[model samples]
Target: MYMALIELKDVSKLYGFGDATSVALEEVNLAIEQGECVAVMGPSGSGKSTLMNIIGLLDRPTHGDYYLSGKHVSRLGANQRARTRRDRIGFIFQSFNLLPRLTALENVALPLLYKGRSPAKRTRKAWDMLERVGLGDRVFYYPRQLSGGQTQSVAIARALVNDPQLIIADEPTGSLDSNSSRLVMELLSEIHKTGNTVVFVTHNPELTRYATRVVYMQDGAIKYDEQTKLGEVGRYARQVMYAVPETTEEDDLAGVSAIMPVLDKRGVAADKKTKLPRRKSTSHKKRKVLKK
Candidate 1:
C-alpha cells in the first residue's frame, strides 16, 4: 500500500500578472494518506479554496506535479482529468448542491447518469447510497422537503454514488445549525471510516476536533497543525482557555462523582448540558438588598 494517496510537489497556483499578479499557492508540498480525515482552516482569500479546487481536479497548478494515487496528474488533458475525477474523487459542498427540482434519489443518481450507467443500475446505486446515509425513507423527497441535515445527506449520497476513493468537502457544515451540523459531521466521519480519503476545508475551530490532523493556513501558506482526537476534547474543552491541571485516576474519579447527579441511571446526562456549574461569586456576601 502506498503511503500517500495524494501528493503535491512544490506546487504553485498563480493568478493575474504584472503588478496585479498574485500567487495563491506558493510552492506548497504535502502528502495525504489513504482514508485520512483532515481539515484545512483558513480565512477568505487564503487560497484554501483554490487548493481544494486543485486537489479535487477541478483546477491545475501553475507549476509542479500533482499526483493522485502516485500518478502525476497536472499535465493530464481535460478529458483525462475528468475521467480520473469521475473514477476516483467525490466532492461535498456547503450549499448541499442538490438540484432542488429533483428528488433525493434523482439527485444522487445524477453522478451515475454522467457515467452513462443504465437506468436500473443508477437507480439501485442511488437508493443504496441514500440508505447508507440513513435517508432511505426520503428517497422520493425533494431538497425543499428535506431538512438541512437531510439535504446534506443527499449531497453525500451523490458524492458517494460513483464510489470515489477520495472525498473533498468544502465547508460542509457551514449552513447548518448545531444539531444539523453534528449529524452531517458525524456522517462525514463515517464516510472516512469506510476507507475513503477525506479532505475537509473549514474555518471553525470546534470542527477541528474531528480532524485526524489539521492544516492551518494564512496568506496561502500552511502555518501549524497537530494530530488530535475529538474524543479527547471532552475533559480538555476548557484547556483551551486555561491550563489543564495534572490528572490522576483519583482526580478523574472525583470529577465523575461531582458530576454523578447530572447523569442518570443509564449514565447519560439527563439535562444534556443546558448549563454548567460555575465558581461562586466572591462579592455575594458584601451585597445587601436595598428596599425603598
Candidate 2:
C-alpha cells in the first residue's frame, strides 16, 4: 500500500510549562502526497510556522506522530533527524538565509559540502542549479549585490541543489515586493511542476492560484482544507479576500469623529479642570513702557 510523502497525526506543540504553557499546535493532523502543491494559510500565531517546522524536521512535536516517506520519524534522535532533514527536505525562508560573505555559487554549494561532495563536483552542481534558476550570470555576485528577486532566486537554487523530495517554504515572498514575489512564486511553481512535493505558508489569497490544494489554519487547528484547481483562488480564500468590506479615508475619519465625543468627555474634561488661566495682555503694558 502507498502512503503519504508527509503525515502528521495528533500533533501538538507547546511552549513553557505548567500554568504558563502556550499551545502552538493542538492535535493537528495533516497529510500530503507526493507532487502536491499545498499552501498553508493563516494569521500570525496560528501555528502555520510551527507546522512547517515540524514537517521540515527543524522542531519536534511535543505530542504526536510524524511520518516522512512512510517512516515514523517522531521519535528519531536529534542527529538522525538532522541527517534525514538534510537528505529529504529543502527549505526556503522569507529572509533568504544566504550567507552574506559567500557568492551565489558558494552559498548554493554549501549544502553539498555537508554531504561530503568534492569541491569540483559541488561547484559544478551549484553552478548548474543557479543556471536552472536563471541566475547563471550572477554566480559570483555576493548576496548584497543582488536585487530582492535575484537574491531569492539564488536561495531557490540553493534549496534545489540537494534534489530533495519535499520543499518547505515559510513565507518565501514575505520580504519581497509584488513583482519579486511573483517571480519567486513562479520559480516555486516550476519546481512543483517537476514532480517535487511543495508546501508553503502564505498570507496572500491571490497566491493560492499556484497551489493545487489550500489548507486554512486557525488557533492551531485545521479549520478548512480543500482541493483547488490551478490558476484559481481557493473558494474559502476567495470569500475571505472579497467578503471583508474595504475601509476608506472618509470612513476612518467618521469612526474617529464618532469616538471624539467620548474622548472629550474623559480626556478633554480632565484637561480643562487642570487648565491654567490666560495671562492679561502684556502687549499693552509693553507699549505703555515704551512710551514712558
Candidate 3:
C-alpha cells in the first residue's frame, strides 16, 4: 500500500492554560497523497489556519502524532523542525511577504541564501524559477513597482526556489482582485500539473475548481471531505453556492412600507380608539387661499 505524503493522527492544538484554554484543533485527522491538490475551507476562528500550521511543521500538536512522507515529525525539536520545514515545505501567504527594497530576483534568492548556495548558483536558480512563473522580465522590479498579481507571482517563485515537496498556501489570492485571483490560481494549477503536492486555504467556493480534494472544517474539526474532478466545483461547495435564494422584483419590494410608523395601519387603529383629533389639512387650506 502506498503511504500518504502527509498524515495527521488524532492531532490537536491548544492555546493558553487551565480555565482560559482554547482549542484550535480538536483531535483532527487528515491525509494528503503526493501530487494531490487540496483546498481547505472554513469560517473565521474555525481552526483552518491552525491546522495548516501544524501540517506545515510550523507548530506541533499538543496531543497525537503527525507524519510527513511517512516519517514521524510531530515531536521533532525546534531546530530539527525548522530544517525539515525548509527542506520539504514551501509557504505562500496572503500578504505576499517580500522585502520592499529588494528586486524580485533578490527576493526569490533569499531562501537559497539560508542553504549556503553560492551567489552565482542562487542567481541562476532564482532566475529560472521566476521564468517558470512567467515573471522573468520583471526580475529586477521592486515589490512596490509590481502589480498585486506580479508581486504574488514573485512570492510563489520564492516558495519554489528550494524545490520543496509540499506547498502550503494560506489565502494566496486573498489580496487580489478577480482577474489577479484567476491568474494566481492558474499559476498554482500549472505547478500542480508538474507533480507538486499543494494544499491551499481559501474561503471562495469558486477556487475549489483547482483542487482534487476539498476539506470542510467547522468548530475545530473536519466536517466533510470529498474528491472532486479538476475544473469543476466540489459537490458540497456547489450546494452551498446554489443554496442562496434568488432575488426577484417582488422579493425585493416585499418588506418596504410607504406609510410612516405614526400613519401605519396598526397605529391608525390605536389612534381611533383614543379618539384623538386629527390635524386639519394645511395643503387643502393653501390651495383654497391660492384660488382667492
Which 10 consecutive residues of model 3 have the lowest summed lDDT?
253-262
Model 2, residue 145: distance off in Å is 0.2
Collision pairs in model 2 = none
Task: Kindly report which residue stretches of model 1 are placed more than 4 angstroms away from their true locations once superposed.
Answer: 1-3, 230-292
Local accuracy of candidate 2 as per-residue lDDT tens digits, 63-161: 999999899999999999999988989999999999999999999999999999999999999999999989999999999999999999999999999
In model 1, the worst 10-residue window by lDDT is 283-292
Instruction: Rank by TM-score, highest first.
Output: 2, 3, 1
In order of lDDT, best first, we have: 2, 3, 1
Q: Is candidate 2 or candidate 3 better by lDDT?
A: 2
Give the CA lDDT, 0 to 100, for residue 118 in model 1: 98
Q: How does candidate 3 score on lDDT? A: 0.81
Q: Could you tell me which residue pairs clash in candidate 1?
A: none
| Global lDDT of each candidate | 0.74, 0.82, 0.81
Candidate 1 lDDT over residue span 1-292, tens digit each: 5648899998899999999999899888888888788888655677788889999999999998898888989989999999999989999999988898999999999988999999999999999999999998999999999999899989999999998999999989878776777777788888888888888885444555566777766667775555655432222222211121223456543433322321323223212221222222323122111100
Cα RMSDs, all models: 11.8, 17.4, 17.1
What TM-score, computed on C-alpha atoms, does each candidate reach? Answer: 0.79, 0.84, 0.83
**What tens digits encode model 3's per-residue C-alpha lDDT throughout 123-241?**
99999999999998999999999999999999999999999989999989888876788788888888898999999997666678799999888778997888987865656554433
